[model samples]
Target: MSALEAVIPTPQVIERLPGASFKPLAPAYVRIPKPKPELQQEAIRIADLLKRNHGLDFQVAVGGTEQPGDIRLEVAPVAGVPTGKEAESYALTVQNGQLTISAPRMRGWYYAAQTLTQILLRSPEVPACRIRDWAAYPIRSLHVDAARKYFPKSWFIRQIDRLATLKINQLQWHFSENEGFRLESKKHPEILSKSYISRQEATEIIAYAQDNHVEIVPAFDMPGHLGWLLRNHPEFRAGEGEYLTRMLDYSNPVAVAFLKELIDEFSSLFIGQTQTWMVGGDEVFPMEWIPKELAKRTPQLSEYAKRNLGPKAEVLDGYMYFLCEIDEYLRLKGFSETRAWSDLLYITNLMNLPPRMQIAYWTQWSELMPSTQKLLERGHQLLNVSDRYFYYVISNRDDCAYKKHVEATEILRNYEPQVFSEKYPSPVAQARVLGSSYAIWCDTPETEDYEQITRGIWPGMAAMSQKTWNPSVKVLDEEGFMSQLYLLAKRV
Candidate 1:
């Protein structure tokens, strides 16, 4: 096999050179010419990775010119490449017994370090090659349902480092769900009745993620998936039915106000850290129980619809009204965009939804849900978290376990950010896609421990890193991919 093929999320350009492999000599240094703090951090990280993986003795020497056998990190324009200045793009060249990593931005330098580490993992001697690589999508991400499973802060920190190595830039922490609320809330201390991630720990996780060139997209799913919150304040519940209790009562002014405050309390914590907030809008009243629950709502819902939606608005319009209120509130809290699942079926017109909202097109399980093509044509940007391709549902049930295994092979062969359905084989233009993500929904939290969860997701996550980084590239079959993945796998 070509040594270049060992690199995951394959580079856009690879040119093999005629020379001996460049192996780092002992007492080598990761030479950083510039004294920028960020560059220093990158140099330290690269040096540590080399030490851990290859047992090479390397030191991070800041403010130095490159010497022989030195791994150099530089922040400068990548010459000769016409489109080299994009975000997270990097060029790596090994020649003249030295390895140099160059990019125009911090993230590019970080990714170049990752590519270098991956190549070195296959063998201590680096192949003589030049690789120019960049991500096709800007928001390559992974959504973890910690709300259900309650992973510790260390778990998130570990995963962020792992993800950064694969060039996955975003980690969406789904910290709220019907079963549990994983974030500590001082305002509502009772919500921390279950295992939770505290405020200080979350801050640490965010800092760690940023250091590793990863952004933490905090997801506090609202309106729906409110079982844990409603359990403490049942007055805010829409209905007493089994499923209805999971949803917030949008009709009640007091309830909506309470939720807005709740959102403000937690969202304010993440204000400076992240610009995007995910207000999960999936699997609400779009199913057969819509009418049954609609009738349960007091006359306040109708009043809310008429006043906020329109004079002739129906009960279902309440969803859009509640979403808009939350969206507007998030904007006030300094969020530039809100992300949600594509279950806004009650929205009669596209103009009614928030302009800054990006849709996570996860499912077409509901016939009433809008088609992926329709949503794109109507000018909504989408992140394809297609359930068929990307969901890793960990449950004890036979069907759920089957789904976890079934999609593993399928994703390796055919999944990509633009793919939502097999029926619509034509992919949407890259301009309309923000990127894609693999989702780990722990429907049954106790079914597996954190180690088990990581093991379960390893293969799928490996496949996803490749697919999201460059969706159109040729992929290895399941067996080939897994073999290469195991050879390249390093937990740290």
Candidate 2:
């Protein structure tokens, strides 16, 4: 059978004729009714995809009325759908040489369009199919840390569009860090001016991400990794002491106010009823730095640390104080999620946190699985972003892993059932395991060959996605799965 026949096999020919004359469907004509901004955009995108893949011509129309066509879309509005609803609730009926999709909201319409697109992509000869699908995870997400290395706005938008195609609904944008801050914060102009390439570039990227089905969750690394911010505003530092490169002074109310204002500006720009802010509370090193700074300014700190934490515990005591203060400030401003590397959980008393607060466990070390178990036992939600499974940067480049001399091929080989069985499946893991994310750390992924990076990561990440989506799915036969990947790549 030919490629077209293989994708769209005819039951009658298979049963009786063995080989029969068959003609594929003609170029599709799509008519969109009551098209809103999002629905229209989705329809256009679907049309473009069809044209690119199958040489199908789509004639699109928008109104409250109906027209004779191969496919018809009716877009309407609904009330009960959650905030930032991007799809419509549509009913599709195909009969008598025409297909129709009717929905009450733009989100529903967008969803219906996506279903149609998938059907067409999967089978060119089949013009009709029925599907009723919505997102399983309410907060389907992707997290990209631009602070480690900045990706251009166009590149960011391309990633967003690709995720939207896969039905992934959110983009957690790590916008600021010690290495660089990418967003245009109103309170701190110097954040982008001193750190990023340009502020206009950041805004344009935000707009592009929004245009796709992804919501951008802006993260600003605070307290521990605020060195870049402090470099610009020396007054924000805890002490005259030059360890300012390491930590911020939470004892200073001025510094607290700075964070509050930064969050407020982020809320105005990105956060919404459905989307939330991620104040990164991870990788806070040199715990003693803050207490020492406070010791010089406030003579009481020395006595306080000695009395409460004992002499040896002074550093940790000070770090915990900073974490608590930052968490409180974010809560006051209506932020819901706070992400930190797994190490933070072991060192900090994060149990009994506010209900709005959610933690992201970035598995950097082997101990992260145990830390995740501990946090889950304390009744907290977590996003699993393990470097072994999800770090895309590591998979892409040969230079990233010197210890193993691992290339993409080696990374893919190492990611078989052995790794999953031995390392990933800790004792007490469950569905509260919200999802898995592959980190595209900017350091290694600086080149234009992002497609190769994506290829190396996807097959392995697909295993992770299956594990997160359905734990019962077995990790057997890597060769079989790799063959599937090659077939999928050829089709695309």
Candidate 3:
């Protein structure tokens, strides 16, 4: 196989060099311009990969003079290299028996290291080649719904390792749901589930993700999917009645205030870790969730709508208004961007959501959800979490509970980030799309073990990484890709 096919996500440009293949000697050296913390970390990562994959001991060094057989990583503004957000671009050249990886940022170098390791996994003698690579989208991500089913901290670390290997850069940790709240909550101790990741565990997870050059996008779904929280504080229920819905009662001043305070408390943990946060707004009202007799059945919602959203506003208007308030509050708290599932926003024609609030376009199964064009026309940036292409709802049998198991092999062969939905087929413009995300929603965590879940989603995640990085590039067929995967199974 050619060197290009050796890597999982095929490089953007690869051309064979006219010389002998480069081979690493024992006690090889990984040299960086300086021993800065970021540079040192990357060098060590590359060294570790070499040692683990090929059993070739590589020593990390600083400011080394030229050597015959050595790997050099540098970050600078090369004339032809991509700049700005696409700085993840990198150029790896193997010539004159030496290897070099150059980019404008640390992320680029990290990706280059992964690519190099893949090539080495194929053979110690890497075919002389020049590869110029960059992601088509800036936010390739893997989102895990850790709330419904509590995954151990080790599970997260293992996935992060695989994510790094595939060059997937973001992990959307959906840590809250109706069944449970995964993150430790000191502010509301009563809301804690029987098993949840503690504050210290989260800190370690975030730090480890950082080491792997992955950013964790903390997701604390709100207003809805709060069965655990509402069980503790029943006053936050949206409607009256002893059992009422778990949705937050926006009409209650105390509920809204408590939501904001909770947001503040959780934001403290992820303050400097990330600038993107997800306040889930999906399935707020299951069927008939929007009471037809809003005035009589949900007078508080009707009143809240009239008070905040104009007179003559309906319950749908009230829901939209509440979401806007959350979006605005997150902006005030210094989050550059806020994301929510694309259920309510698409149902209404009201373009109330601020442009800063990105829409996670997951499904268009229901006609109520608007087309991709309408969302882009609204000037809202979209992250393609298309359920058809990206969702991996865990299930054991053919008749899964949520949806059929993800056709990972088919996705590896024929999926692209721009295919937002299966029913309403429209190719989203590359510029408007932030990137694509592969969601692993554990509807029934007991259905599969952690190993089974990982095994099932590995292909889908790797395919997502390949397609989002450079969708136009030709890659190995499924069989060839699997062979490559098996060779690099223990890379991380």
Candidate 4:
């Protein structure tokens, strides 16, 4: 025997003991010990998957049964589930021809289902074993730039399922950029498109994500990536000429208010019991003021900007102040967790920033461990996306951003958690890491090669999932990972 094995993000513990094993799942009926609406729906989804993959009539049973095809689910906390950190831990025991999964939370049970589904694909039979598993980071996020380019509705839902199988619990919805805003709002009817997700469709996507154990963290990059929005509403744009730059005019109070209104709309749709919001404060390299040198003359604006913000009240300072105001406003409007690019902390002089807003540290090909350490020192939690490692590339090189082709395997192996661990060895340092989210940016919506993109998402996403789930993890067996990938493809 090749020893007891599990798929990507190999389990924490797997012990084999001599006993009767399930030769096959045995025409099983999946049952829940108690009525859990979420648990029942997840069980049904996985059972339906098993039926499709292996031609097994794995019926979904709501309550316990002693019949032959019995796979009972029990809910309870893992003996030592972490209190301070979010825990997605579960225990599965297969003994005496019965398989039972126990979890402390609904998410745990759903993850346990994913693990078992993979095991089934390898063999209908499971050795008499006990497996205990939990995620290393509370947030394993995947970022999709639907703002720059849009994807089909089915694409997002299928992606939710695929990400869940890899145990990614969050989807960072980057739905606004310079190219387009891929959401429909009655207030902003001018920007609506045939391809945009309607209000009704957005609601459906949210529901689908919840059922599949995923949280959608929605984002609309402000101030900078607003070419499309500013083009439509030229009064809000920063620079002017026959060829006006697309950046939003930060010194323009009307423009600042316009961005806030968009945030209000974004919050109304995304904020529920558990959604998060982010304002992108990245790549504001050019210092563009609407009036060119308005701050140099306006004492009131420059005084507030200089006093509350840093001392040097320049164009960039105004931009930072504007972002901080929006951040605080979103926080006041019930978004306790506001996120922005780590550049807000690294490059800008924006002081008295909302310390509570989580930072997503991503910069291409630059060593950000120091930046992450800096953020941690200031008591800020961060998600280590570190763009170079998590970015996905299209084969055709047809997108506006990336014109060169990159392999999915390279993207998969580009990152490791060791860098951060080595940099910050203390317990406090460890906890400040929110988790990692890989970005798959698409700048041109029209010319995407679906096959190439889908292939990249599967194995590459699997690699990211495994690394973030267990930061110390490495590809020990190439063949084993490939085998796992094949099975995962069937489910995806």
Q: Which candidate is the best by TM-score?
A: 3
Of candidates 4 and 1, the better by lDDT: 1
Question: Over the stretch 173-215, how does candidate 1's per-residue lDDT look in tens digits?
Answer: 9888888888988888887646898899988988888888888
TM-score list, all predictions:
0.93, 0.69, 0.94, 0.86
- The C-alpha stretches of model 3 lying farther than 4 A from their native spots are 78-85, 240-244, 287-296, 396-403
TM-score of 2: 0.69
Superposed model 2: Cα runs more than 4 Å off: 1-69, 73-122, 127-129, 132-136, 185-187, 193-199, 234-244, 286-328, 331-334, 346-351, 364-370, 394-431, 443-492
Best by lDDT: 3
Over 322-377, each residue of candidate 2 has an lDDT whose tens digit, in order, gives 55566776566665565544445544242244444566665534432235556676
Give the alpha carbon lDDT tens digit for every residue of 1-492 in model 3: 665676988887887888876788876788999879978988888788667667888788897685766899878643454445456888888887788889888888888888888887767677788888888788889999898888899999989888988888899998878778889978887888899999999999999998888999988887788777888887778765532466888789889999888888888788787889998887776545444644567778788888886776877777888888888888788787999888767455543777778899887766766677877777888898877778788755667645675665777667777778736576877788898899998876798788888887887788888888888876656677877877766565
Model 1 CA lDDT for position 362 = 78
- Candidate 4 local lDDT, residue 361: 71
Per-residue error at 429 for model 3, in Å?
A: 1.2
Comparison by lDDT, 2 against 4, better one: 4
**Residue 101 alpha-carbon offset, candidate 4, angstroms:** 0.5
Weakest lDDT window of 10 consecutive positions for candidate 3: 77-86
- The true-versus-predicted C-alpha distance at residue 177 of model 3, in Å, is 0.9
**Candidate 1 ranges beyond 4 A from true positions:** 63-65, 79-85, 290-299, 398-402, 422-425, 477-480
Candidate 2 whole-model C-alpha lDDT, 0 to 1: 0.52
Q: Model 4: per-residue lDDT, tens digit, 1-492?
A: 133464667776777867877554456788877676777776787676566556667777878554654677777877554565336898878888778888877777777877877787777677788888888878888888887676778888889878888899899888877778788877877765456888788888988888777898888777667777776788776555422356666667777787787777868777874546878877544323333654553444466567665676554456567777887788777888888886535433444356687888764223322355566656678787755556664434544344443444564465654333223433335567777887777755555665567676676677777877875555667667867787678768
